[model samples]
Target: MGNEDAVRDSLLIRGGFATLLSFLLGSTMWSATHPDDGSAQLVFLSSLAFGLVAAYGLTRPTMMSLPKRATWMLILTVLWAVLAFQEPTAHYMIVALFALYLYRLPLWWGVAATAVVMLLGSGIGVVVMGSDVSVVVGPVMAGLVAIAVAVIVEEVFMVGEDRRELIDELIFTRSQLAESEREAGVVAERQRVAHEIHDTVAQGLSSIQMLLYAAERDIPDDSPARDRIEVARKVAAENLRDTRAIIAALQPRALQGGTLADALRRLATASHENVPGLSVEVTVGHRSDSGALALGTLEVSLPIMVKSVLLRIAQSAMANVRHHSGATTAQITVVADLSAGLVEMEVIDDGRGFDVPGALVGASGRAQGGHIGLMTMRQRAASIGGTVEFGSAPGRGTVVRTSAPLEGHRLESQHP
Candidate 1:
């Protein structure tokens, strides 16, 4: 049962026990005072009646019509008070007063009932035991005390309930605010991706289109320049394919299946088809047991951002192979290991690698010429607490490996 139900049940049990005890005490007192009299018999029957009524009220279904229950309780309270005056015993009156409090009668009604019961009990005690002022005063004082205590307890309970409800409302509002912030972040990231594509891939494709059109106009139909023009056309076609793949990978509709493997495979397939004589191989580890990685472990933990970064890395790697590596084959491997809490990606190419030092120096010199792709890749990796390593020599092939911790271990452990 819920807390409220448990509390109500406790109240009902206590009320029932108090009622039975009062009935027994009152019956015993009447039996001793007037053993064979009609008045003693009447008191005995009234006590029994009060006990049965109190039990019925206490055991009644809580969810039943409140109005109906309240009406019946009020009727019983009146009968108990009237009968108590005739018997000169205050037990039924006490039970009736407790009923009013337990049922949560209105404040004005409670106050009025308390006053009436005190006056009635005091008058009865004064008339029946004329010599004892203590008898009248004590019962009156006890009735006032019971009413005051009941009111105080009810007010305190109500205040606590109000505070609890307020706390729950505040928690709900906070959750909604968090969700709104996340949606806003996603929108901002999408805009950033769009700007990047427009600045780089779109501009490059436009230039290639213009160059191919110019070459077509200048080269004769059967000349050596025509062959060169054909090669440029092929290069432009490859760049166009790369641009489309970049768009697809950036948007990443492939994440509908709930894994990055499908998107990466699509990227590798597109790369192989676009670059002649360059074979691309892809290997993806099992993701069935892999848990979701956190943003701290990978700057691109979000599916969209992850796809964008991977596409850029793949594009840069493929471009380097085609332009400088003289490679015939490339291997791409993606691994997601939840148990180890790591996601690893590696791109290896069997190409004629150049000196890493020379390339860095060259890249640094041309840094002003917008050689920002490699730098951005490094920055992206660092943002996610991951590391990017590039290995290459004058004769050895190039291998690029990136590893990021899954499950956001750092963030998870730090949360309070």
Candidate 2:
């Protein structure tokens, strides 16, 4: 792909230089064949050679030194202006220079330079050649026309830059979201295995132990049945212990030290630790019977993956704030409105927000920048039966809100 682009650009530059060269060469011929004045073709050829070399030097890659480019443009501008006076066909050469001047130089200087060249061409045509009034009006009209085209071209380049920025941000957001989803899947699988062990192997072992104990009590001490029943009870107890150990091993690593409640609390409070000037406050929506917040104070049957993804989404959103938005404050709020059958999570930032159209159009799927963060949040939430919303405008701040069903999407805890 890179090679193809290089070839295409090379072809374009070759074509443009060929066109400009032809115009200058044709103008030299036209003046040389002048019916009245005997023209100096040798001087025209010398100036043309110098101008072409200067054009090459000026159009080198941007990595080249600015002084080098300035020297080249200065040489070319002087040569092209001199050639315009000698050869009428060289007017086409000056037209091409107008584009380069606008592109290479600052706004005011480039315009002034191109306008001066055009005026010089017109003045030379009328005063030196003793020409008609058409020479005066033609160059002015052409100058206006060229400037209009240059303005449009500049705007197109600016829009391209904006799109490029959007694409870069999109790629970053997609990568983070994909990693989160993969982690969530692994945790969910572990929870499923733990669930199977608790509901099947552990329950069966308990029943066997109880039945063996009852049989041992019923049989006489001397009977063989009593001995077998006692041995069976011991075996069942040992098997139960082993099965419990296996179930513990199958639990997700993230939940081993603390419950999901602790992780959520940490996520909410730690958001603003790295970013200075930007303050964040965490607010909990659910409370226990003892009037304590349910987030970190009590164990809830929340999935470790759920807690993890929530934190990830929050972190990603905050990252966007720092990168894109120039906001000063951020707020994170979690509310498990059980009566409403939903656990809602919201991240609000007072930053430069984008226009989020309908239905949470997850990132545009282009690896580069445009609106990928919100798309990532929506996808992560939707995977686990949750809904994500985005709201923002140019100057107004951004709001990210997501909700998951309480019972509909709950994962069984390792302890439970």
Candidate 3:
């Protein structure tokens, strides 16, 4: 819009200058050559005044409406036509009016008007001034050339406007897609919350209520009613504990919107806060690495599902290191390759390692009641097109590596 306005203003100034020049040269010529023709002088002077006013009206721009400009252009056209008939030298004024007509009138109308003005001006020269063939052909050919140039320029402007409109529509479509994805995420989270409550807190509460009811019915002091009460109290306490744990599990508050690096840093900090005698350093691969993203470059963010899984897997791996691994030093590494569409996370600990098969069995309840930390981490990785692997030996330290492909999951790395 701004570019079109600039073009319009420039053409207006050119037209005004042309009309002024025509009027000056024509009126002076009329005064000297046709001194006694007062009527021609009057016609030329009146046309000049109207043409000047109409040309400058271009300066007060109003792109959205055409009525005001159309009125001025129509008046200018009639006056210029009359002035040209009186004095053929004033025909230069028609060139200025042609610009206004081309800009304001419809296609067929503008062409017809240009032809009418050209024929009228040439007719005046031939009939009144006894102009020869050169006068007749020159202006006619110039008029045709001018109309062609105007049409080409207008077509270019129309193409530019169409391209800009397409760009805006594409932007709007992307915004709509982003909004729909957000809403889908919300719906998925709601479903998760419903399932967690029904399976954990709700079921636990129902069991506790039943146990207390049985204790109340058999409340005989001599018939083991005290044992029943104690059992009921224990069940109630366990239920309460389970409920709190379920709430905390449902709320992975540390994990939120951020880059993969930010999520790792926060997870490392939280582990340091919650565990004693453990100092974990979080680091990322250099830009030169195979699957490592460059720091402080175009942001490559992980999906919410991927972010959540990565954070949880890191937390679980760290907890295992703190409790089972005797050594205190641990390192968490994050690497991503946007071009290759790959992401990998590793938690390495300088602690005593154990038999991997035994750990898996113990976690699956095959061995005496064991921690599910490792098993849970594996499940979390698998939830989002990911993998979990451990490297360990009796004397060596443990390294838990998790990897996922950013492309196969059809996830896009958003740039901020």
Query: Model 3 off-target regions past 4 Å?
Result: 1-47, 59-68, 211-416
- Candidate 2's displacement at residue 126, Å, is 1.5
Q: Which candidate achieves the best lDDT against the true structure? A: 2
**Which digits, one per residue and each the tens of the lDDT, describe model 1 over residues 78-98?**
656555655655433554455
lDDT leaderboard ranking? 2, 3, 1
* TM values, all candidates: 0.49, 0.67, 0.46
**Candidate 2: misplaced stretches above 4 Å?**
1-11, 22-49, 52-59, 64-71, 86-89, 102-116, 141-193, 209-253, 262-285, 288-295, 303-312, 318-339, 346-370, 389-401, 408-415
Tens-place lDDT per residue, model 3, 1-416, is 45665666576555665566556555645653565655765764765676566646654655525666667666776776566666666666566656656755555567777888778767766886677986787568767876897788778987886676556544554564465456446534844684567457766676777777777677877767777677777777677667645543443355433455676777678777767677889887533334445654323445546656777678778877767787678899877665656678889988888788888776554332223566656766776678899899876999999987665332233211
Worst 10 residues of 3 by lDDT: 407-416
- lDDT tens string, model 2, 234-336? 9989999988777666655534555444544465455556566677776656644454455622234555456556666676677777777788888878766
Superposing every Cα of model 3 onto the true structure, what RMSD results? Answer: 22.5
Per-residue lDDT of 373 in model 1: 39
Global CA lDDT of candidate 2, please? Answer: 0.66
Give me candidate 3's TM-score against the actual structure. Answer: 0.46
Query: Per-residue lDDT for 97 in model 3?
Result: 59
